[model samples]
Target: MQGSNWPIEPIPNEHDVYFRVHKNYIVNDGPYMFKPRAFVERGDKADQHKSMSTNWEEYSTPEQTQSEAKIPMDNGVVAMSVGGLRSENLTVNHAPIPTIRAHTDVNGLPDDIKDVEVRVKLFKHCRWVINPELSTNP
Candidate 1:
């Protein structure tokens, strides 16, 4: 969800926070984790120095654990993998929730549909933008 022109808004919900991104552009990326410039590894051999001394016998991989943990994601996706099952929790960020473009029908065509206000939350980094629109009034 990067490299596009769109604005993002963050709205607080009763249980969770909602993020919305404008779909005016063909591509976008944002709400991403930002690692400082010094922490970034570069060049083709950047990953060659990673530590590899962990003992496999004493460590339990995520696949062996039955606990459910929230998978960190960019662009407003709440992904999770638990008990060997991979599930995706999609919010308004991943999809282009409809908005009033002056005037449009329920199917997105110009018509007499009522105009409604939308709220959203997002983050930006570099040339990327993350957007997620709220589907309901809050």
Candidate 2:
């Protein structure tokens, strides 16, 4: 309910892209090889670094999200198009931080079956933006 109070903003263009960071463990074989769980947020684990939130590419660049946002350098970034997600019935809203929320609801909660389907679509559509294994910083 944190974003519920925030003013609703314009959604990113369909052609626009967003970024998601994945830890080393999320990588199956290489940086390009990603696990579906990477796109799914688990309620059991807290995102202490993100303040229990996820940031989209519209608000920040992949490098900034990792460096400026204080995410670990060892993590890799995956890029997905706004249109692709929308096609899957997922909503991309820019509520100050630019978040990916469920199309049916506004809170962006990720515990339901719809969220699971969305995660799978994200996994299928995403491509490597920054390969952790090839990154000089990593």
Candidate 3:
């Protein structure tokens, strides 16, 4: 047979891929580990958080770049993607957390979501982060 070609692979989604990285905010936090600059601090036990986040350069959703503010009357903002949520890492100081979605519907939720988006806020930037800083010393 003559040389044959194959079609491009379909992008990862809820059906095939186990993880669903957003096209707008795919922040792989792997780089923030051992930068030669002041960004990273070395220690005897530097534990990798193993998150679906990005480095300092890429853009991230608001919740993906920073933790949500905890207060009585504050807007509920969660710092974890749906995937991080299933790992039982949601909420702080009690109460349900909110998710960054564009609409109230959950049809377009990313596969990264372990559970579901409580509130809907279109993820437009990178801000949420969970880089737990552990002390190397006793």
Name the weakest run of 10 consecutive residues (lDDT summed) in model 1.
100-109
Off by over 4 Å in 3: 1-50, 58-112, 118-138
lDDT, residue 94, model 3: 14
Estimate the TM-score for candidate 3: 0.15
Native-referenced Cα lDDT, model 2: 0.50
Model 1: residues >4 Å from true position, as ranges? 1-45, 48-74, 85-131, 136-138
- Per-model TM values vs. the true structure: 0.14, 0.59, 0.15
- Could you tell me which 10 consecutive residues in candidate 3 have the lowest summed lDDT? 11-20
Report the number of the highest-lDDT candidate: 2
Clashes of 3: 23
Query: How much does candidate 1 score in TM-score?
Result: 0.14
Off by over 4 Å in 2: 1-8, 15-17, 28-32, 42-58, 68-71, 97-110, 113-116, 135-138
Superposed Cα deviation of residue 5, candidate 3 (Å) = 45
Error of 3 at 115 (Å): 2.5
lDDT (C-alpha, whole model) for all candidates? 0.20, 0.50, 0.24
Model 2 residue 23 CA deviation in Å: 2.9
